[model samples]
Target: MSQRPRPCRWLRRPGSDLGLRLTLAAAAAVLLLVPFTVLMLLVATAWPPLLALDAHLAATLHAGTSANPALAGVLQLWTDMFAPGPLRVLVGVVAVWLWWRGARRVALWAVVTMVAGGLLGAGLKLLLGRDRPEFLDPVSHATGYSFPSGHSLTAALGAGVLLLIFLPFVPDASPVRTQRATRWTIIAAALIVTVATGLTRVALGVHWLSDVVAGWTLGVAVIAATTAAFATWRGLPARRSPQGGSGRPPPRDMPGRT
Candidate 1:
């Protein structure tokens, strides 16, 4: 008589390293959230020092940008390119591509991260009801509450999502130097984009420094939360595969896996 096939060992016992990564991700989320919460309280209370810093930077940048129309124009263009709406669309396209490539879980995680970040940013904006910097000769104009900069939040989220999704493809193998170079290059590029987005928003005089900082922290925190949740659900470690493939290993239950 034919006997029933046994279940895959993975299903019976999850990867051993998942718990540590999950804990780390959770810790990251809390760490990011703490500073963001503090900032929110300070902004809500109109803390004198924070307000003074915001005024000082906004005035300084405005003075320079307003004098140099060319620089202001360039910053405006950069801000438009990295706006939350465009970034969300780009992330959606990437999610579709990921799904087609059989990284459905990662794709889903990407979608969730973008959607959650967008909603959270908007909610905070409404809750705070903060005003954008007002200038007699404003270098740039944005019509919305501006406690946490939407552009900054979206840019950070976009960079982070792209990094995590593509990291698995970095060949971490025999060529140690090449692998390190590739990984650091990707990391640096992401950092540059994220930081530049915030700086441009501030230089354009549309967002305060604190606004940009809050956006950065919140965006990262959201990513960490989702990553931890996904890792736990999949019973997989939150790490890139040694094989330099997708972000996570295919479970035995997956169609192409054996």
Candidate 2:
């Protein structure tokens, strides 16, 4: 008889896998649903706190737009680069490259995470039917329902997925200090990209501050869920060989296997 794979240290505790999964599920639910609820409240009643913050940001950022053409130009460039179309193209390229490198599962996860984030953002915008911020003159034009900033959502999603995918490449045998430094560097870079993308959306007056917040929250939830799922899949025991011995499965070229 083949022996079962041993559980990890944490899983060896009282609740085991069920407890870990439930914890992840609860965290994901709160991260995903709370932002959604707040968005609905904003849509249904124009929640005062959110509205006031949006107005203040718009007034502060939109001031002197005409005087700082260069700054406006740079922000607009960042906005355009992180927009849905360009982001999709970038995701596609990364997916193709990963496939070429034989990391098909990682590639698929990245693509799905990004595409799902975009679709979710679009669906929420349509359902809420909230209008873009018009409290001040928009330095850049945007046409769509604006309950959630798509650029912010996709940027966050991309940053998160990329970070997770690359994290495993860090050598486990490295000195603890080196590992810690590398991890922090990766995290900082991801945060910078995600925050910069969201800030540009608000700075341009094309999206409300609440819109960006919801986008960031939702994107993080998606990343968390995907990470949990992938971990579960990886932890599954390898199939037994026909010789009545357990062994790892033979590698195969399976696209979108995740």
lDDT of 2: 0.73
Residue-level lDDT of model 2, residues 76-166, one tens digit each, is 9988877778767877887787777656666766787787788888998998888887743457888998878888888888887777666
The prediction achieving the highest lDDT against the true structure is 1
Candidate 2: worst 10 consecutive residues by lDDT? 4-13
lDDT of 1 by residue, 1-258 (tens): 422222111222246777787898899999999999999999999999999999999899889999999998898887888888888898899888766655566778889999999999999999999999998988788999998989889998999998887655664443988888888999999899899999998898889999999999999999999888877777744467677676754543321334
* TM-score, candidate number 2: 0.78
The best candidate in terms of TM-score: 1
TM-score of each: 0.86, 0.78
lDDT of 1 at 75: 85
* Cα misplacement distance, residue 132 of candidate 1 (Å): 0.5
